[model samples]
Target: MEQIIERIDQLWQQFSGQAAADISKLPQSGSDRMYFRVKGAEDAVVNSAIATYNPHIKENETFLSFTESLKAAGAPVANVFAVNEEHDIYLQEDFGDRSLLNELEEKGFTADVFALFQQSLSKLAHLQIKGGENIDYSKCLTAREFGKQAILSDLLYFKYYFLDTLKFPYDKQALLDDFDALSTYLTHTENKHFMFRDFQSRNIMVKDGQVHFIDYQGGMLGALQYDVASMLWQARANLPEEWKNSLLEYYIGEVNKILPNPVDPVMFTIQYNGYVLIRLLQVLGAYGFRGFFQRKAQFLTSIPQALKNLSAFTGNRKMGIAVPEFDKCLQFCTSAEVMSRFEPLRADESTPLIVNIHSFSYKKGIPSDPTENGGGFVFDCRGIFNPGRFEEYKTQTGRDKAVKDFLEQRTAMPDFLNSVFDLVDISVAEYIRRGFASLQVNFGCTGGQHRSVYAADALARHLRNKFKVRVEVKHIEQEAKNWINP
Candidate 1:
């Protein structure tokens, strides 16, 4: 760590003729690269920049070369400010912490956010088309170009790491034949544009509400649709179907603008769908390797979402080319019985018992406990003043501020929750100490839309924050309402 700081200090002095003020390490991501924010002296001309230390000198060189090439092509990429004598440590412009994904989560999928997506896709087309010119292919990290070899590498990655690990029954030789056919078909794309190997929301930064991209070190010469597939189908983003179609059309339109002659829409659609399948399988392989094989909790949580994506993709659409064995394998992978294996762990057999809490209508009966133990506390919130009785609060649920304030101010809900918290805290502490697994808590009321929902949400939040135990919350009646309205 000290050596890295020393290197950054040296680079700072060499570049800006000033001493370093301080260096702070940034959070690590999936990649092996280490980043630090280097601050300059109070009055120094050089402001703060991100300094990266990568052990892979070849990848560092590729990144530096790509940065220069892409920047000259008018792409919104981070500029390399300086590099040490070893070429392993370099400083680049820091584009702050906000990402497009963060923005989408903070704000909903509105016009403003969609506009950003539009701008991003427009820039991406330029990055692939204009940025492909005069680039040295020798500097590519792995394959000089994305072709049959690269496609097979991804398919084989899925096979060995994910598919084989699942131990699902299949004709191995037949699947291999299908894989070869699929790869050969995808390689016949009309144009070989620059492929940003891992183009997704997290890699896109939003500075002053404008989009800028980072982390293109793995880029290579490839078809345009691969990157498009990567962005629109990013697992966590879970973009709405309407938004996905709109954005895809928007991207193709942008690509047509820059092309000397527009690409054939029919052929482009076929190839694009093929690439989507390729990207989905590649991501599933990644999640399986990181989650199932390595036992990382975050990656494990993402499995169901990815499975959901695969299910939706295969449900209605078919690739232009048929690989029957691959289709059957995909069906098996997405089957309900198969997906059940990847569902997140239930608390019953695990340490630090997670309390599953729910709000439900008494009329609909209480929700059944999913845990094997099957019994815990159930509080009736019908005794409290009903927020749903008031017309103003009828449409609102517990999560809304108006409903919360009303429950806390106009009623004795606080006293009710205070007593409940005191009771639950006892069991929670003892469970943690004894390493017991599951607990259930329920709140019920007449309508289950306001008071019960509020109480359940409150208890879930309190338990999570106070005791640091996992808490899963469900609002049965409210969820039904959302389904009806949504």
Candidate 2:
């Protein structure tokens, strides 16, 4: 990462003929690409530039080409400044840190947030209608267009990664047949355009009282409803039902003004709902793959909310098509028992307990409690089999699938956590009874990189699920050197 940053700064200087005064990293998204802001520039890389480092050369080219074409069409896309000869790093207009998601979260459901969304959605309608005009489909990362294959892939992604992992009983073949039927129905939508496949608030940058867009590298020729659905029905957003209806209506009205052939308001909306289901299912699949399979805490926390959203959508709205088998699968996935499998029993607002779980190296010693109440639990995790001992797992941390699998299957991690949970449960109950506000739990190991991380995550998960308390898990040594969540 240090090497990438240094190289990117050099590239920025070479392009602009100005040494980078400061270069700061941006938060990483789901993609492997890394972003940085190189300040002290005079050009329209927004007075600086967003330096992007991505290893996928082809993806970089597609993004550059799309940016060129989209900007030419008056789309609100970032202007590309320069691309390195290798096509691995480039600079583009910077929109700063504030995003539409940040604004929505900060402002709540006020009229201000509504207007911002309307502004973004209005831009989206124009981008969809104009951005794809004569654009080269061959540059797309995967499918040239969001055809039936891509649609089915999303469905199967949900089935294989999310549904199959649940160990729930359902007619597999029948469910698949239904998946085909649903995909076919969605693929037949007439209003295809430049689909920003990940058109969510996080990607919509808010700068200088306007909305700009990014992360459309996955864009392709597809339905307008897909992008709209992706944004409004985003599970984590938990947008109001009323807001969803109003915003959808607003977006259609905006699109009608720009579209050569105006969309039928009624039919367009029904298709949008279908795309909404597809978007929800696709998100669950992503959460499963990155959370349940990869052991990422952030994604795991979102599962409960996603399940609730799915169930509500199914219950309240008619999907305009019947797929009994798909509906059966949905019922199973969104059932109370199934949701309970992933959801933490949230403590009442009145409950004061907040568990802080830490993973630390013995060399650095056990993590000290920051609060005035200094005494807390610190358990030695050295007894567990160390994945760090083997060369195969040395580079992988507890967050990786291979290391987590090794720790769970080959080590005594389960039994150790089971014993730990039994001991902690008593104290947690006692603490809540006593109206205590804070509980700190620390796990110590030889290196703090592998065993301790896994144990700390386990304990946090256990406490959140069983005790219904807030849990904050930190990798002490890993975080010290920025080793966590990279």
Candidate 3:
């Protein structure tokens, strides 16, 4: 890999690269799979380089054909300039560094931002372009397998993290019963459009103040609401409930304008809520896996926020969907009786075990049943009581950065987190001794607000289901006080 990178640099310097144009400071960010940037003869080149090792799309003629098709369909994608199939390298146009996330945070959102988002949706609705004519949504794991795998992630999350990592053990029958109910709720839900899985703030780049989509490899024929839920319930760029509703309507309007058969807004909204729950589960597993196994901190922070947002949506009346099992899961999070079950996991040791059992002290009402109180849970077993252990992880700016990254990664945590949590559970059970476990699980954005509080509650509830001992969930910064009484 080092030699490849060096060789690429050498070739660029020899060919298209120029001394006058600095490529070193280009706004480059990516996953382990690929990375690239804009290269220029001077500093005025309109093209960029997209280097990758993804064999599926790298050497295949399908990628080039896909780009051509996208262009024909009037999609605002980067133009392919050059390709090195063997090495998975391609030079393309440089879209600006400004993301919808940056724009909304900096200048505050405007009609233009909304309009661009709408336009992107409009283009997506009529995505006549095909990367390959034989593409089947069912053949891929994303569509056919997504529904089952996604729901399973939530069960696994509740199993490992809440049960194993946090040492919350419960009766086997109850756990199975709980999961069965949840599974039934998830399976009965309807499906919708070919969704751009990560269609949210960060992926939707604003180049020249126009929205250009990226990170769309996971696209699938799925639910429209899932994408809508993702855009609105996204951790990093969370809009107010009112704004979220308006955006949903706006997206539906865009779809209606382009499609031959107009979609029923009410029906779309219902499906969207179900997708939101599925996405949340998938996100938790994704984040947990990334954080625990892959050493990606960004995934760690997203789990709480994603779960909280899902909890709120399940209970929200405007959603008009009854995700009963999801609501039950949320209710379990707030049950003091449930959280107390983690007491057995706590060890009597030199440093005291800090178990934080959570409740709805932040958001006033649960979205599942608007009149009912349904907040998520938080379980922090990290030994923060020790100053030395605490100091090791504390970094001022890094905390803020972590929070930001968490918000960004919110929609993709459940599946990742479940994988991580499962590994942690298996590993810990095999190796770590029964002793003090101190964890700090934060579940909020910009103070102890809606998403954070709800997630904290869910985490707590999940922990309770796993253990037969006592666990405490604390709202570190909330103005109000609400604790579940066993």
TM-score for each candidate, following the candidate numbering? 0.73, 0.79, 0.58
Instruction: List, residue by residue over 1-486, the lDDT tens digit for candidate 3.
Output: 345455445545544644323333233254534454535554444434554434455323434544555556667666765566364555555566788888778766677766666666655555522322233444343444345555566567755544344334445565556566655554554434455667778877787757777665565555456666677777767667877777778878877776567778877776566667556655655665656566553455455555556556645644344444445555554355544432223233343334343323223432121212222223222211211123432332112433333323333333433443444333222222344343333443333433344445544554444332235655544434332222
Residue-level lDDT for 3 in candidate 1: 80
**Model 3 score (lDDT):** 0.51
**Candidate 3: worst-modelled 10 consecutive residues by lDDT:** 380-389
Model 1 lDDT per residue over 297-332, tens place: 346557788988889888966678888888999998
Q: Candidate 1: list runs displaced more than 4 Å.
A: 41-45, 345-486
For model 3, how many clashes?
66
Colliding residue pairs in candidate 2: none
Number of the top TM-score candidate? 2
Global Cα RMSD, each model: 14.4, 7.5, 15.1
TM-score of 3: 0.58
Sorted on TM-score, best first, the list reads 2, 1, 3
